[model samples]
Target: MDVKYQVFISSTYNDLKEERQEVIKVVLQMGHIPVSMEFFSAADEDQWSLIKGLLDECDYYVVIIGGIYGSIEEKSGKSYTQLEYEYAVEKGIPVIGILNRDVNRLSAEKRERKKVNQEKLAGFSELVKRKMCQFWSTPSDLASNVATSLHKLMNKNPRLGWTRVLPKEHPIEEIVQTVNVDIPKPKNVVSNGILTERDIRKVLKKGLFDFGSFIDIYFIIEGLYSHSNTETKLPNSQLEWIRKNEIPAHLQQVKEIWTRSYRCIYTFINIRDLAQKRGVPQDVISIGNIFISYIYYVLTEVWGDVPYFNNKPELEMAPKGSSNVKEIRTLSLANLQSVLHDSTLSTQHVDLAVGVAVRWELQAKNYSKAKEYIDKLINRDRYKLAPVHEIFSTDVESIGYFDTDQEGSQFHNPVFRVLCKKGRFVHYLRYTEVLLMATEIYFHLSDHQKALYYINLVRIRNNQPQLKETGNNFIATLLDDWKANLGMEGSYFSALKRNGYAEKVLGIPAFKSVLPIPAQEIALNPNMQQNEGY
Candidate 1:
């Protein structure tokens, strides 16, 4: 079989962009794929997880060092390039290191100014020298050495690589191209041909739904056990098993799925203006805006500060910047808030904005603002609490094979239905959730009467007795209702965290409130800081 090896190029990005591109070209010219951090935003755990997955899959690893030592991760106190090299070594992957012969001889702009980074770079260079290494002084020379070194590495210890029985032919220019030139094509044009209105609509629809499909139900299922004293809580052993295996497996999957989903959204955004001009429905184009705002909200909520791409869709192709969580939240809020009074928006869109606004304001502890948004939803009279039986189900479609049974029968395992299954609508916002949100907001505002009134609506709908308590009694009643009604819907944990019950209920440390930025991410970006206690 004809095979092509995957070569992962590790280096500091800004200083070595051109040189990395040159090396990438040589790899491509030799008929192989080149993987690098240049195509990723490596500042979060998800990104780091994805990087490790790529490194695990690639056939060989290559490290190119320049004057700069690159970013250092706080946890390990080592640069990301060094971390990548070490990981490759630990994994027993073949490594080819290219070190600059003399940093002192390089231009001042290209040299490290900080005394600390200089020492670290010297040490790192020595470490690389201990392995199969080469010396390069310039980009062209580096590319030549990479081509020669990779050839030797492949011949010495060949591995199973990607192969196709019948590979599609490419044009001569595309095959021989050394650098990416953004030759501007028609706004509606794509790799194949003109992006027709049908194509635009189809992609937008997929982009809108694909994002919803990416929401893992495990997050919701895990939330049900987040609080203490739940009968359904997984045993410590099962929880450990999930943390060690399932979560990481899904995280890798989520990274891959979300990466493709973002590209789909980006494609729609890039051709949106043209699609609109081409007479695609306004509703179709509107999906792009709605998808982006909601995605930003979801991403920031999970990843703290993610790489912002909506404002600059081009960065999706070549990411080089970071976004603050708060700023992205503010933008998403503004985008949603702006469309509240939009005459053209559908009721579903309007309600989505209001419900999300309520959650956002609640997250910020602006209870009064949250109440205002919730009132817009409740006062409209279009929504009402549904019976618990109507809203939830006990149907078992497929059993999740979590074999806690020592004898191999998974009869006692918890069966979690796939949330991303076709035609299954994952509820992002629900009327009952909004009702409980109103209850909390009203309680915070010291309006016990309104709080009791809203909570009673859901309680009465579910054939449960109304809550007649005030003060802490009312707080307890409201929280119980939130868990009972919104259990496994992904909102209970947020409610616990929001109501200051996480520590008391979950018994986790305050530092565990936020997730840690992946060590590789911090190592890649010197300015990036890890979360507290990480």
Candidate 2:
């Protein structure tokens, strides 16, 4: 019932006949109606006129170019195909050209005919070069190329440029009023000495509190809360009772402590100094100490932590004690790591510290050590940490303590399963990953046999079935597969860096491979200097 398809085909009779036939067959295969003069015999003037009308009405025009020039009729002195192509161009219709190479490679007389044909086709080539017309070298390439181009063109969003245009009588004042607005200011204000509820809410909302403000507010609140005697001191409660009641409360407290700790550490240190000057409660000072210790552990593991505290003797004079109420200030990664690794550290405390370290190491791009610590923490049974995927999965039954679908459904979320739990620690590094890294190093060192052995070892674990033999090409393929599969697990970037491929693969400038002195650190200490590049 519907007149669905249409295309106009134009080509020289002598040279492009075969090519044009191929194109017509393809057009039919693509489910379009084709109109061409070649399909009809001579002496059909009525059919010829119908074909010309179809050519003008059809959706697309196809031009086939071959070696031989089309014949010049004795009286008209112009080829019908040439005239059709010119008309199509003049009408601003989309045209596809197929050039037949077999016809191009012909005898001298045929070549002369081709030269004449080209002269007729010269304007079309210019249009094709300018991207106004699409051209294909062969008939086979035509269908695929045209289909792909049309698909892409149809999928592209049409840009709106003239939607605002209207009759000259339209009111401009209404449009101007719709686009303008005035900024508003908050009504409540507080004095600088003490933070009011509104001031606290504002600071929290803006996320503008520095480390000093964090320490001040946290310590001040913690001091008042600790003295308030809100916690029910349960001396003889059973394990089950504690788990059902006291433990939940304890966990809430721990969460608050860690949240405050994180904010204090990340915001900068002048707040802690301010807290000390203001004579904040001892437990409040301990919170800042513990936060600093956690940060130091992460920095040390990743960047070969510098001993800034030891270098500054005045800072090392803080009290040293095991009580949570006292401020024990030791500034060194080694000290921080030692405290975290200590067996006597409470499970809750160690879990919080390890979680912070893992997060920091990952953020600092010290993934290797992060993996190592995560693996250690996960393997410990007392910690009750789960497997990475199990912890991160979106299946409601399997969602770990840290998993949240706030951003979207589980399927669309980007956070890894293992890292989902807020305080749940998991072992990240496996022996297989270490072996893979070693294999990559061996490959770089040109120890082909050793490299193949290690690569095949990992492949076997992955159930790949086959063992690769020693060779450059095999190693390259193994590396390619490794990068593809092991990527996002945090290996690809490190491998790129280790193998001198960071610049090539990541587009990282060569100077960025090494750590630079942070601008703030340099500003604080005149002795500090930046890395080679800013």
Q: Look at candidate 2 and tell me the lDDT of residue 220.
A: 24
Taking the tens digit of each residue's C-alpha lDDT, what string does model 1 give over 1-534? Answer: 557787889998788889999998898778776677764445544455567777887789999999998877778778878888999999989999999888789889888999999999999998888888999999999999999999999999898766532212232233223112222223332436554555554444334434434444334334534542244433333243223222222232333433544544554454455456568656554545666676565555544566666543344243334578667777777767666756666776777777777777887789988888888888866566544554433111111112122212212123334321111223556788878888899989999899889888888988898877776567767778887776656577678777888667666677655444433333333345556564
True-structure lDDT of candidate 1: 0.63
Q: In model 2, where do residues sit more than 4 Å from their true spots?
A: 1-333, 346-391, 394-402, 405-492, 507-509, 514-528
| CA lDDT scores, all candidates in order | 0.63, 0.42
How do all models score by TM-score? 0.57, 0.29
Candidate 1 colliding pairs? none
Worst ten in a row by lDDT for model 1: 394-403
lDDT of residue 233 for candidate 1: 34
* Model 2 CA lDDT for position 334: 42
Lowest summed lDDT across 10 adjacent residues in model 2 is found at 158-167
